[model samples]
Each structure stands twice: as C-alpha cells, then as structure tokens.
Target: MTSSTDRVAIVTGGSGGIGRVSVERLARDGLAVVVHYAGNKDRADETVASVVDAGGRAIAVGGDVADEHRMGAVFDAAEQEFGGVDVLVHTAGIMPLSPIAQLDLDTFDRVQRTNVRGTFVVDQLAAKRMRAGGAIVNFSTSVTRLQIPGYGAYAASKGAVEALTLILARELRGRDITVNAVSPGPTATPLFFEGKTPEQIDGIAGANPMGRLGTPEDIAEMVSFLAGPARWVNGQVLYVNGGAA
Candidate 1:
C-alpha cells in the first residue's frame, strides 16, 4: 500500500512557532511526520493532536538537534515507525539578538550550536537516510540580507547556515535530492512577539509591504512545496518575508 507518496518526514523544533506550523502543514500535505522537540512535551503533544485531528499521521519525539546520539535515535524512530524519511525540515534554532560589542562569547556559542551546527547535524542525518528525490529544507533569517541592528550575532549564525546549505546542495547532487534554506522575515510568533505588546507587534507588522506579520502557516506553505512535488526547486534559499528585507 505504501509508495513514495507515503514517505515520512521529520520537523525539528516542532513544539512551537514555525516548527509547529510546518509539522501541521506537512501532515496535511500527507507525509507521516515525526514531531521533534527539545523539551516541552506538552506543546509537542498539542501539535500532534492538531495533526491527528485533521486526519494526519504524527508522533512527538524529543531530541536535541545539536546532539548526534540523540538525533540518531530520532532517525531510528522515524524509520521504525514509517519505513524511511523522505523529507527533513530543520527549523530548530535559537536567536539571541545583541550587538557584537555587547555580545558575550557564551551567547554566540549557543547560537552557533543551535542554528549552524544543529542544521549541519540534521542535514547529514537526512542525507544518510533519505532516498533519491528526498528534500532537506533548513531555516535561515532575512536579517542576513537586511543586516538589521542588534542582530549581529544571530545573523552571523544564520549566515553560516546559508553557506553550509549552498555547499550541501552541491555535495548531494548525485542523489537527486534538494537542500535549500527558507529565509523568513519578522513574523508574529511567540518567538518574535514574546515581550512585545499588541501595539508593538502591529507596528512591526505595518513595516512589511503586506502590512502584517506573517503567520506560521505562511512559512509552512513554503516548506510543503519544497518537501513534496517540488523536487525541481533545489538548493535555493527562498525568502518569505513579504518584501520587508
């Protein structure tokens, strides 16, 4: 009964924000999803509930993207449950924004560990397990293009991600797989609006050409395209920022 159409997917950081939305969208698009979260089992369970409610297949799994052994188990679980992975979405990242002059080495290290190294780890694992025609989509930030103030450390980490993705695309050319990054502008997620008031969030949204902060669903739509039936769209960093950057 199974074919390439029933292949599995893993979305890292699926507990919240864009990750949660991506998981739901991929499930709706008909891929069996492994909802990978670092912590927050409650939120992860909520994500799974949403997917199953919509008549999709999903399971919540916990692992640190930057940890190899833990990620290995995540891969093993996906294979055991759904046969093998055909899509990998690396959305697990940390962004602590501060000017380099005020930034401590510890903050920079953490950002790199989660955003840069974490991406590399997940991509490598996906490549190992994915069949030809598979896709690995990573997350980057539009700040790398806009060079926004107070985002030096965070942008540097994503900048590394951009570079890694370009090389990865070429490295896996023979496999007929696609590796790409999706760079999103400011969106109205808890991560983006955590401490901001409603007015503050509105002001941020008003700056975009679309006159609104992006929803997680907006980003998830792009992920769905890259993961399924868009195999020709490979190794490219598609921006979903609504002309803000």
Candidate 2:
C-alpha cells in the first residue's frame, strides 16, 4: 500500500470541474500534484492556490494530454517539482451531443483524440515512468450504462477507455501498479448544465435516483481513495453516481 506521504501525481485536465476537485483532493492527501490543464490558465492557478493554501504542494501546468511530448513534459514536471509520479488521474475529455446521422466526423475525431487517444498517451507515459507501487485512475462516464441519447459518440469513446483500462491492468499483472477507471453519472457541472435552463436542470436531476446531480467533491473522494492506499483494487470501473445508474 502507498502511503499518503510525499507521493507525486499528475492530474490531466486539472483545471475543470471534476479535475479541479481531484487535484485538490490528491494534494490534500499528501501528493505533490501536477495540475495539467489544456487551457484555462487562471483556473489551473486557482487549483494550485487552493492546494497551497491548504498547506499542500501543487503546481499548474498546461499541455495537451494526447500529445506525447506534452505528456512527457508533464511527467518531467512532477519529477522536477517533487520526485517521480506515483499516481496519474486522467480526467481530460470532450463531450459533444449529436445523433448518429448528425454526428460530425470532425467532432468524432476530436472526441476520440481527446478521450480515447488522450487516455492512451497519458497511460502509456505513466506505465513507462511509474515504478512499482504506482497507480493510475482514468475518467469515463455512466452514459455507457445509461445509454443516453446524444451521447453515442461520447460513450463510444469512453467505452474504448474502459476496455483499455481493463486490458492495461492485465498487461501489467505482477507489477504493483493498478489501473482503473471511474464513471460518474449525471453531474452538476458546467458541461451538464450548459445550454439548459433552470427547469431543464431540475428535470435532469429529477431523473436520477439520487434526485440530484453529482458534485465535484463527491467524485473526488472516490478518486482520492483509488489513487491512495487502496492498491488492492485494480482495473475496476467505479461508478461514483449516487445510485443514479
């Protein structure tokens, strides 16, 4: 089991909703966190400030998680600031709503690039750099099970992530590292509430068994545990929704 002391982690997309929460949680858990943001430099700085204010170590970095060179620099930052990365939490992704007929091939390619290929690139870097006692946690969505309309392409990309995670775990069998994915149900993020009115937001929340949208902190809790001492759990897709799915 890894101790929550002096460990280092790289959280891709660490500036956004769930990513911010995960970075904060990991930093609080005693990991020197590298906050990876594609853009949103202000938000990334805010994440770093929040962690430092809480007496934890953290730094914000900008990079495309799908870019091998960028990801390598991220790993390098983790080592330069702290030591080596003991954990990786990839939460960077894009979701575009469209029916199969209306789905833009350009958007589909971008989603695959960011979601599926991004996970692959970062996971590959983690696998190569992380020593024994390391752990990797990925982000997926509960849409795979909910089969929500307009999410066909998005869910398909995440499905690839799920499969990659499972296979990668087995590929690393006998190593002390564990790879897993987290799938959250409808969450009350900007993405979820975007373009929706108050009534629509309530309606969406009402559809969930929990009667509410998920909070970033809620998902972060699971991420914290998975990346921490729970080394025994490997290659599992943990659903963080409140029984919504």
| Reference-based lDDT, residue 159, model 2 | 99
lDDT of every predicted structure (CA atoms): 0.88, 0.90
Local accuracy of candidate 2 as per-residue lDDT tens digits, 100-161: 78998999999999999999999999989996888999999998998977898999999999
Model 2 local distance difference test score: 0.90
Task: Give Cα distance to truth, residue 117, candidate 1, Å.
Answer: 1.0
**How big is the positional error of residue 2 in model 2, measured in Å on the Cα after superposition?**
4.8
Error of 1 at 123 (Å): 0.8
The residue pairs found clashing in candidate 1 are: none
Top of the candidates by TM-score? 2
Error in Å for residue 224 of model 2: 0.8
TM-score against native, each model: 0.95, 0.97
lDDT of 2 at 51: 91
